[model samples]
Target: MNSTTVSPVAEVGMLSARERSDHTAFVDGGFLYVWGGHHSVAGEEVFFPSDEIWVYDMSSGVWTIYAMGGEIPPTLSQTCGCCVNGVLYIFGGCAENGHTNQLYCVDLLDGMFTWRNVTDSTGTPPSPRDKHSCWVYADRLIYFGGYGCKQMREVTDSRRFITDEMSWVTIGTMLFRFWGWNNEVHVFDPRTNTWSEPQMHGIPPKPRAAHSSATLGRMGYVCGGVEAPSMNIHCLDLETWTWTEIVPTSTVPVERSWHTLTPLSDSTLFLFGGLSMSGETLSDGWIFDVHRKEWRELQHSHRDKPRLWHSACLGQDSDVIVFGGSRDYALLADTISVLQSPSQSHCSDLLLFDTQPLPLLRLCEDCIGRNARTLEQQLSWLPKKIQEKLRKRILFFRTAKSQGTYNSR
Candidate 1:
């Protein structure tokens, strides 16, 4: 597939040198937000960055760093999050001290954004966990499997535990330990402000963490993880509350963890990048057709951009914005990241993967964005996401100064 990228015509404000893993990224309004990922050495000694959030304005290509308000959650990563009704909600990740189940959110619509700790929520949140998948369905937030804070009833007998190697690796004098991964399901209903664990029937996927998921219609699909069933795909039917394993007729991807599964539409999903079970960071891309039950690989120009624990968010006009991930995968590594060290493959690059059939459409949109003032009436009906994307295109275009510097179609 042909893909192109757009860079900020120029950076603004205080730009952070971020090299992180297992962080969270979500889209809201006309902007994409990235927050709370950690950079650690040898997977134990963690380094926390500023209490801020990174915002990418789709219209202007201006990358701005904003100070977090309200009660900010500690610099966190390996957590999961999603945006709903302009609010970004984050749950369960490894903090500086340990794992936490604390639920926090920030309203992106609020000009002076503040992190609000949602304390009024009732019932039990899942145990503190990291690397889980968060899904927004039926106006509810659903979280599935991750390296937990403690073993739960849903934890199966098979699966590898991160702490299993505790005896070999040492951060200093302290020995690092964490709970194993489980296939537990937790749901939070914002209307009632309550949390509930559903009694799922049928055979559940093996307990695993660092997996990837995307929800379509009433079915929630999960693929790849650590240890068992790493390459298998399974979907939970939200209507019937049953799990059915999907047997792909074509090629099956390498077993991986920390990969990203992005829904391009309700029936199609995109898969890319992760650490394979054999200890390699994967860089290949695949597209899964939900109805056909087949996997097709994506051939792109950016093969060298291998990343794990990174994020890929589908943007307006079929664009996939990938950013902020480390390249050093245990294995099965794929995707892209910025920043490079002798040992660190972590990057802070904000890449735009334009996956459009006609590349010139992007240029036409840019033209419209540049002439938005004169053409306001013609573009008024566009969705907020598309409008922002069009407006933001000029942020780089103006800086390109007729050079088209960042255009790589």
Candidate 2:
């Protein structure tokens, strides 16, 4: 077995390194969490600090580390991330010494790394950039405008990562360019592996990085990030490809960057701590309901100092786990936290309600919904009998649901 260590704080509620390690890009298939900044061990400087990826596991409630491949790159702030088919991809950021156009991919299932030469690509990847906005769709990884290295100005370069072809393609350029800003959203079509130019039809507040975007159903929402004086929430419709400016009705989070946004089952997005304009980091949290278009301040609090550039992930049972980053202006080595999902009075209200209660002779709707594709992919993982059983069950659910009798149960 790989060398694994447990945390000293064995409290059932707290997270451990084992759990956090699962958040690293390309860990646990295609699951992704935020990556907090790196710090050193006791009395020792952090090795390859800039190249290290820190992840938090909601299951174990701990922080874990994974070393980046090749020589460690310089320390970078405000990089961008996305996941495609279980691979974690990171793109352009400003290192301590300079800006970078490097693109790296890590496989979560096997813990392997592959670095791509973006500069050498025939399509010409974006110039060395920092503080960009990025996302993944289908199999394409798309990155938008960011601050350029030489000009030190925001640019409109659009680059893509195509997994099947294992190549980088520069799509059409952005309509506008601005850096040190937030509120830009881009979507890619994996089928075509190309990007649509920045949609100007919507009332997108303004272009900004350090903001967060989460997709619920077909709609995506962007919320709070540094925009100078204060932060605000905004929504985008993936279907219409338009923006809806939202005036957060409840106590909202402070404006900041390098924070996290995670999607919950009920179409709610959680916002965690980030760096404030005054250079102060935050530990406070908030939740935004996309369906209702509202925000609610979280009452619970943590003992750890406020931090920025930390990572967060949703785990089984609706628990949210946070991992390492800087606290009180210094990098942190070992810190982890887990926040349980708010209690629900009805079992049917649990996120798993639709997926549970494995069918006996019949197939459970939940099983078919969640595991059907996974089972098909790993047919060899199960015995022939089990595979047959699952197939039978799926057929039953499809027939029942189609007949409209499944809901009667």
Candidate 3:
């Protein structure tokens, strides 16, 4: 079978030049908001929680940076977040010192921009965690499994016991460790100023973190995460309070973590990119039909560029806007790709060269067919004498090729 070169469906705005990964992003009104991640500079990890907010105007496809005000949250990455009514809420994430339980809110309005800590409590909040999944429903934040702090007794404690009491009176001290995974379903109601872990019906999902979640109507769906690299799909019916395992009829992707799932409509979802179990960063895309419970993998130009721990959101024109992530442990920034739905048949308007390697001969042949005139126009930038000689050689080569007398290189 002959393979064909396919360009991106569309190209829009790009992120800033700072290489970053593990950031959070969401769509609010007519803008796309992105912030808070870390980048490596000469083997040093630098976080960007206090960096100016990056905003992309959906209508114009332009990016702008806005300075944040009020008390800014500490530099954080691998955080969980959700958007409700133009307000972006970010929950616990790991900072320079350790994981944090702080909640930060930022308003994305035109004339009313503010950043404030909104963690007031009439009830208990979830413990400090990172790599969690969060969704917005009924004016509340619904948080799912995440990696967080946990306490365990020292190993020696298990060996000591008293025969009479069947327990040791004095045992090894409790030790705190990070990176415990849980399947607790925590809900935070902004109106009630409280957090509650409700009793969910049916079997809960396996304890995993760095999975992806999305809400559609009365149900919420989650898929794939760490600790277990199996392609497991689970759903929670908010109205009925039940968990149901969804067995897909088509191809289910391999086990991966730190990917993103964005709802395109009430019954359709766009899934893309993650770190796979074999230590590879994936760049493939897939579409999940919620009603049919099916998965269809996408083959497009963006498939060659792996993006783990990136952000994706639905754009104004129903295009999926993808932003920063990491590839091969190297942070990626400074570019954004828009995936046009199949309904949009027009080819891409911009051509971008990425770090991913491609077949050079095929790329040149494609350019000769689609952009020969553009290349000819650019030749004017060369010196007049060189340009004239090159133009003559090109004319002679074209004439010879048309007459079937040109020799193969």
Considering every candidate listed, which one attains the maximal TM-score? 1
Better-scoring candidate (TM-score), 1 or 2: 1
> Which tens-of-lDDT digit does each residue in 160-236 have in candidate 2?
21111111121114323222332334444434534344554566555444555565665555654433224566655
Q: What is the lDDT of residue 280 in candidate 3?
A: 70
Clash count, candidate 1: 21
* Per-residue lDDT over 1-409 for candidate 3, one digit per residue giving the tens place of the 0 to 100 score: 0002222122323323245677777777766676776666556556765736766554334455566678788888678877877778889987877778788887665434468898566677877777888878888899987766543432122111111111122222423432356777888887777888787899767777778888888789898886645665688988677999888888888888778887777887878888787757787788888779898886567665677777778764455767666665422221011122222111111112222244664345434433446588777687997565455445533443343321221
Q: Which runs in model 1 stand beyond 4 Å of their true positions?
A: 1-19, 39-50, 151-178, 330-342, 358-361, 366-392, 398-409
lDDT of 1 by residue, 2-115 (tens): 001222323562243366666778776667787767675774536555357777665565566666668888777566889888778888776767778989887766555668
- Which lDDT value does model 3 have at 206? 79
Each prediction's whole-model lDDT (CA): 0.70, 0.47, 0.64
TM-score of each: 0.79, 0.58, 0.71
Give the higher-lDDT candidate: 2 or 3: 3
Ten contiguous residues minimizing lDDT sum, candidate 1? 1-10
RMSD of 3: 14.4
